[model samples]
Target: MKYRRVKPWLVAGGCLLMSACSLAANLNYRALLVGVSGYPGLDAKLQLEGPRNDVTRMRGVLLQRGVPAQNIAVLADGVPGAELPTRANILGQLDRLASTAKPNDYIVLHMAGHGSQQPVSPGSPFARDEPDGLFEIFLPRDVGAWQNLPGGKGGAVQNAIFDHEIRAAVDRMTATGAFVWGIFDSCHSATLVRSAGGSEEVRMRQVSPQDLGVPATAMDRATPRAPAGTVATAATAVAPSSGAGSVAANRGGSAFFYAAQTSEPTPEMRLPAGHPKRTSHGLFSFVMMQALEGGAGMSYRQLSQYVLTRYGGMNETRVTPLFSGTALDSAVMGQDAATVRQWKLTDAKELTVGAGALADLEEGAVLAILPTPISGLSEAIGYVQVSRAELATARIEPVDYAGIPKKTDTELKVGTVGRLVQQAMKFSLSVGVDLQQCTRPCAFDAPLTRLRNAKPGEGVAGAQVQWVAPGQAADVRLTAIGDRLWLMPPTLGGQQACTLRPMALKAACDDQMERSLVSITLGSLASPGNAAQTIGRALHAASRAANLMRIASALASSPTNGQVKTSVAITSKGGRRTAYVAGQVPRLEDGDKLLVTLENTGRVSVDVTALYLDSRYGITAMFPRGLGASNRLESAASDSFELEIHDDTLGLERLAVIAVEAEKQSERADFSYLAQPSLPSETVTRGGNEADGNALFRDAGFAEYATRGGRPAAVSARTGMQVFSWQVVR
Candidate 1:
């Protein structure tokens, strides 16, 4: 069944006349913020402590961004003097905003509360189209009062706002050529919250269908169905537009940012009373409000990352935020096209961005330089790397100008202003595993498990092995010795000619008899394949997940940037020897001293922190106490400092050095909190400092940074920061 789209309500003749007169006026900025923390007449289990506070914080951010007080509307539950956020009041306000908006106007609709899903009644208008037999809904303050009403009637659904309703309102606004931004800080699932360690009391804001009078039979009958004209797949969903047109097709387009994925839960937290920033807020709202401070010239993508990095830093991994919109790269907070200005090129190669450490600029970030008068059609002149970054400005060195038009007179010169564009970075690994020798009756399964269970400095941990094969995409794990990689026990079923390639000439290998590199294909194992191949793929998936977890942990703990010169010294009994070559991976014995020389060109005080991820995938803080001295380096005119590595470090280890400018002398407490060591094998540590660090670096913001191996951007302050990664093998 095709549902008819709702039409916008007609304004009175006088109102239309007034609108026409104001068509040429400055673009109006309007916002409708609905935050519900109290559910009257409902179970206390449904109560929240964040929504009321979320609205106040958001309103403050908007006001600070230059939005007039009269242009914003607020409806909150349990807040005196504020409009009540009942179903009727919320829907009425949406309609009013849609009908009154004009071309070039900006409308922001932010909803912070619980979201629920209910079964669509049989024969209901939405049933045939909603293959899942459910309606996504926002629960208003009076939702409890309407729970007892019979299904299939308007009155029964009156208290909850449906997704279609929101889509319709957004559509109407977009039809008038206005831009719309919708932020929903709620989720439909309760299982999406990551429980704090040792705390069973944590809860997500969600309600079941039964709690809202949805019959089990109705929900049971709501079986999944393949929609007409579309192939059904586990990864694909086919549904009618919830209400708005495609993000790109609508005038000026619209964007929707949800605090959590559709299946995940959004969380609210109460900070300790003496916390400096806030007391209670949805985690999303808290991070978002903090992101807005000193975030004047950020694109929607940067804004999203600001929230993501901080959210991840909090050690909350149950739900990832989602963003969908046409203007993802556009400035946030509704800055008009005329108001968008480009950063000026101070030197032939350097583009000076007024934003620095506070804006999240890190060394080695790549940014696209776009021609002035920026728009969707603006052409990029070239790309540049952030060679030097500071608190308020960064020096960008030109990487290339191949994108510039050859016939044009444009030259790399001072005072040329251009917009900078950042691209998202993704990491992936490619390797081939030899499977030629394995036959039908191979009996090597025991050895495979032994390889899998190997510890750091033993067996195959941290070995690089290559494979040569043709036409096969199967995954396999192999152990390397000398120049050849041996296939681990339990040869895969498929027959293919494969050979292991020798290690690259410059690459160094350990003295161990057996070294291995694991390879796994990412896809379904249901296809008829050998048991060994399927098992190998599963192992690969698990390893990949573990690697990502480690990456997140490293990001939460590591500092951003500081310049350093490093060398490895082998203090063997034969004699004290130095392996002091810049940029070379050095091999070492059991008792080697890793010498690091630090330099601070900037005047700001900095903290030097180093972390090592060992061959066994274990992480250890190697600097500060780990290395037996304070790693904090103060600013000096001729500053030169040295750090000595401990003797216990082993295996193929990756060392990351981060230097961050001090925010305040007291902020050292925050670093100490993050530096507290976790179990060597533990991938994630839950603590308040992680969340606090998330907020700190997110507020600092980073440049459009990418690394060759897909390492995550190191977290750091925007000013006077640098990061160096080195490998030391023992």
Candidate 2:
């Protein structure tokens, strides 16, 4: 026999794990996890350690989701009882599944490993079929080095699993009326970079074509030009086998989740940054699992939003994750569960939940004790704050609030569950220094020490600063590349410093207007006298930006989010309001005016507050000018607020409107007190008691202000906030 076909019942865990059904059990759910870590054919620097972790965690997540251990087949290096992720085993399993799939069978294929680009293989049918003259590939453990083809006209890697091959197998499965969801956590657009910057542990999931013998010009021809925030002449890593991911998205029976766009890099780092037990794992994998576990009952699009928003909140504008598929509305199965992760309410001595670090819940995160898994926010008997959190369980304590004073242990019905409400927020920022270029006497040492040792009580310290090794999980990195220093958002690895190019300074003060649009260089900040202040100002900007996103992300989960009816628009030059739409970027002209209307759609009257997040990381409170009918829109009534836009900074900006249930007609939830201004420059430094939790504090902002002693304010879950992003153009 020329080939061996894996029997689903024998090797792939088909009917062996279950009794034979009357006729092919309905929805024969199956999964194939391919995680490649060892690459004998590549350089040692190219080897990785995260794929093993990714596979292990993924298996556990699937098990929790109810996928029988036998139905799931794992192919990873170093994982016991699993076959090696060689090209032959991967294809054999795919063929095995495709050949046996029945109509409506749900299948999942997750590939986590190193990906690269190669010229079309010689003597292969795909040779002339590849219009781009290259195949985007996922490297198997047995993948071979690139070698010269027969005519020397091109080159290709031996044993590299090509895109078209993946498409063919997936197509066969889809043709059988099965639905496939493909997830790729690896990137192929590798811009080879110097390893001198950042911590040494973090690794990008890309292997540059240049690393092979491909010439730069040929490599350029092999891939198209990259869009914004990416280097030119890159392969289509974003597509992850356009045939594969798109099959799930465009085909009638599939969906795909991409870790990054074409030409952009994705990083793998130690997860749960502050956790001592944290080990190497792909950030995308960890993030994906956290989102999936949080609520496996949602649609594909909803799941995508959670990953995107949470990622943006942590790493602004670094890389983007894309989800495409016609099956967006399809519900994911944690084995038929469409509800948030929940634990049955009990009379145990301590309230312990089955969810822990795996669900991304931290110690300070808050949860709602609901009457049932599908219970609404109003049905919450009381709230609980996570007291102790571990991998699989957490201890909860009832929190005191005005409406419900204490934890209600008796009034709950049988089968009640604890629902996730809000994740705990830590207002500290971590910064890392990349000194790959210079020696000990370098100029960055002094400033690094100062910022690394920065305090967190008040003023600039309000945004706490943490120093970490380069390449470790960090919010920002100060990298010294030879003679030039660069300020960059966290990059995946070495060459990703490509994003470190000159960044146009945010719209500055009138005195700095001449320099407003000018691109700033980090090299100028390397001098001794200026290093400290420069680092301080930069950190200040980063802190404010991160906090603003925190407000947008955390409060976005307000139990009342979708329940509150609101409209956001801006009056244009012609005096007509251009209503802002979701999923599209809105733009505002210099003279444009923002118009917001709030309708009390819920059971009780709501206090409305509007905030503006600027490109400079400054936040301004726009509503509740102070105490009146306008302050609290009546339960059945509506109100409007407007703010004029001027010729200020122009870039990405956000608008957040929050409505919190107000039991009384007199008291207002003045969240405007959380308003924080841009550093050393513009914004309102106005009203509200600083020491009080209601207002934004001097340095301790949203997280610290809302949760004074690990307990959040009472109105937290009762509140609904919606944030919008628009481009402020001239």
Candidate 3:
């Protein structure tokens, strides 16, 4: 056979693959799973009935599929809600497991529990005017809810987690070039029905315990009615006798697969207390176990077909899997030969970690936390915990080698905030392209590769690139430039190959392009071979909680009196992605502490907002010094804006945000925006579509606040009254 000339880049992962090929048995692959039930507060209402079993069974399936016994790690399988683990603790566990992960290794997560939602505002064309939807999962033994949730009076029951939190975790893992997968079996009603550009009809999700035999009185009295046109999305399929249990929301992504449809029920059966078999698992689990035990060598599609064909249309319970793949018409199929072979490792290793075992390691050992020491030249350093056997064989000292550190092409500065805004751009690009070596510039004349092709935002980070047409040639170069890892063709005609058009305000535009979403940028803060859940949670809480004022102020100003007339009134709304509600009570002041109760309504733990008023605005107040929740700076200025945010609660819990004002009266005007306090102007990074203009007002009376930090609080000749505009994520 004639040999075809191939470029070095074309070999792709050739070195890694060759090494793996040398061994008869595939390399080890691992996973860590944690699920909790028996909550004290909502335990009687939103109990976890299915996910625990599903996750437990999944452990067995992975082991049978060839995952090594030592490779899999699990924590808190049967922990109750009151005893659920802390966010930091869970993250610490995942970090330890990540130590063994290698580039291209697959990491999977399976969660089962409860979910919550926020009330929908009026005029939300896409929703039925119900509560804003929030999705979340449980932390084993977690005693309280997130501070941001509703009705979280410091002692309320904690709920589950949502897509944002999970995506944050996935972003951290995939950045290491490791394939990350998550299987969430909680109730997902909080997810918007109209996202992903799908038809509104798709949002008509099935009802869960609400439809079961549980009395209406047993349901949350706070459950808001769906808007006029969309009243059917409630979970209504459960038998009346069935009580409220945990559920998951439906969020799609190229890197994720939902085992059930948006409108279908994920069922769980109560086994006889002393039954010989398992105690409680849902229909999905039942079918999934059968497929794995058979070892039929079936693809995802074939296996799904087997399950559906065998159990479709069965009386009280039925199962469906919503897969994202190339089959278009079939919802399955289309695995490239190469990609299939890469994922085949999962089939070769027998998952050995039991569901009840704790990882022998901790997070500090497995993941490196990226340190922002200087501008652009940022690097990551971390360590992975390992058994003495692996450490000795890997050859390097375990502690030192465990830390994975890399220096990008850019200089990185320490002590800078807004890193999340800077990282979002990186994440966006990472999700749309493959980052392998290329020797030449991609030909402009060649067919363009659209990075936005796959399920645009599945809440997971990673790109899936397939040749649009066979034999398409668009060889390109991927390199590290500044902090940016550039994906472009090699030098073309002695100049950079790709022509990137910068937006107006050149400096701002450059920063925007180079920024990765806070959820995904893991340099300095992450460790290799391990998941970085801690950094992810901290960043997520900061990014989202920081926006509470902007959203709250936007709604507070929309009414005629510029005040929240009721305790909480749903007001302006746009699409399914965001909603604004107004709640006007006694005006808050700087140093005047206020306590607000919230709850985590989603499946994943949520980051909610609690606003405090600062009477003045000043440079110190604008840039108050603080090192997390414990050591925050108090501004004496009369008009500065400030708020405190926390993460850990899963259900009904409470926390407070104290907004301190500048010490001077003149500064008071600088801290207020609308009748309510708006978010700090610098929060969202004022830009073309992402700017929140309403935030430009320092106080209700001022024309506008400065866009970049440290500018005068008052509008200047060079600055307009409004420096930013509100444009929600579409």
Candidate 4:
């Protein structure tokens, strides 16, 4: 095999560490980067601009993180004297890397190019096995060589590399106890393309089976049934070939991060405003690079979430990224002690760490405090609990172990090292909806369903979970239903106590919007495995409570006009009136009259609009509907709007009062690209009837309107709009 090695350079940047320990003494790090930007094939559409740039960018990241100069290898499309990324050359390098790898070593294989699918041969060992009855193939530089090859011919399979071939090599590396990390910045299907920035072209990054000369009969025979919940992409279907068991057996784990879902196309676009370059990059590759630039400790889960957040912010929601393998919770970059950074104590009881939510830090996360310049695998002196967390900083309070001192004997200074010792344990809880609460057609004892966790950066797809109860255990299959995983329980009837348990629940914000709070009784039978039943119950309950608390916090912290107090009044025709104050509203009944009153200070003209989201996730614009009339209330005037609580408005209802300055209303209109006269009519109603509202929410340009905290942005920089939300329990 022919190849060329690129020596890593000492880039001037902060050390990118994954945790608070020194590099492992015995572990070795190696990388194989293949990028094909110039494909000299019959299909001119295969040429891309991102792959070459992606390799350059990733090489820089690895070097900055201190990978040895001699350990990195590269294969680009057009570099003079460099090895070309042909099928043979690429597979040769993969095998070479696997042979060279040893136990406790780290191997990174990054491929950026076109990905396609080919029909499986009839009666073959791999036939009709994958959810999509086609084998996913990566197009090498010589992909066109097999275009005319006859099917059932001996040489046709050699044209492109199949996923099983890649898996086989990965298996070899893992069998040697080496961790194999694969990053594919390509997509395998083009049937569904969601593009941003008004691009007209749908970039699929795939070639159809017909283009590769696969026989129609073979395809027809292998025409795979769209398995009940199978996503459209072959990437998701082919991931399990190198299952978790293979990865777990290796002390060092393996993982794959795909650029897009199987059915969606991954887009390559020029760098956004903040990046220094104007060159294009795969959306996933660009975001992944940014997530790693922090030089702080992060797990695969944390890193994935970080990327998902930034990617969503870009308004590219068509293709959801996919991550599979056994090490979702393992530290990203590598597992060496040197990859972890040391944090410094800020006070006697609290230490300030340079890792927070972005790094997957959560409340109650335990961290080990090690002295600076950790010499070896030294035992931690004491532990700390994360009391407060921000995007990039966390405040930790020292934990007093039975024998360990609360304070370190040596005065802790800034830059002292700390490592995440234990993650806060969480539980997957299953609760039954009260039989009386079911609307109709409800099963006797089905698990209560909440809002699907479909938002970006939330639940994983196809993950397995188990439901356990006294004398009964049923396996649950999870399918991606919309944006979240839908839990499918076995068809068992009758009310029985049960608790849901996954092998692991990656620490993430459970922001599922639900109608009513599902009460979970953590009985003794609800506990599973080694976790204490009481603790499991408490954690599950706390998680649900946290969701409610988050909503309340959003309202309490909303930007307001001075210290004004708002009140709501319920009145009857008999002239009897009951007043309900903001933050203390009583349970509302159907047909109850609602009079919302607020004092408008003389500071600015306040325009108020009432927004409602019902139990079915149907959002409606409740007020200010007529045309040619301003929703604005005069300064220094007390204004009131009358609304009735509709009888059908049952379950959890959310009401948001949006107040914007009348003077900046034009700016708001311009930002949303809607004319001033059409503003009031653009209100969203149930069942997606309001096209304007749907467009506003769907556009990434207006993503800032939705806050990361799961609330609408209370303050708009461009238009000075302030929003306040309240929950109306009916």
Which candidate's lDDT is highest? 2
Error of 3 at 44 (Å): 3.4
What would the per-residue lDDT of candidate 2 be over residues 613-668, giving only the tens digit for each residue? Answer: 66555678887765343567766787777877765665456667777788754566
lDDT (tens digit, per residue) of candidate 1 on 428-527? 2222333334432323333344444445323222221122233222122342222222322111112211210112211322222112122222122222
Provide the overall lDDT of each model, using Cα atoms, as 2-decimal numbers: 0.47, 0.62, 0.28, 0.49
lDDT of 3: 0.28
| 3 or 4, greater by lDDT | 4
After superposing candidate 1, which stretches have Cα over 4 Å from the reference?
A: 1-26, 127-131, 145-158, 191-202, 226-249, 272-278, 335-730
After superposing candidate 4 on the true structure, give the runs of residues whose Cα lies further than 4 Å from its correct spot. Answer: 1-25, 79-81, 145-158, 194-204, 213-218, 225-251, 273-277, 335-730
Worst 10 residues of 4 by lDDT: 500-509
Over the stretch 287-398, how does candidate 3's per-residue lDDT look in tens digits?
A: 5454444322334544443443222112111123443322222111111121101100111132111111011111111222234212121443332221111200111112
> Which candidate wins on TM-score?
2
Task: Rate residue 689 of model 3 by lDDT.
Answer: 22
**Order of the predicted models by lDDT, top scorer first:** 2, 4, 1, 3
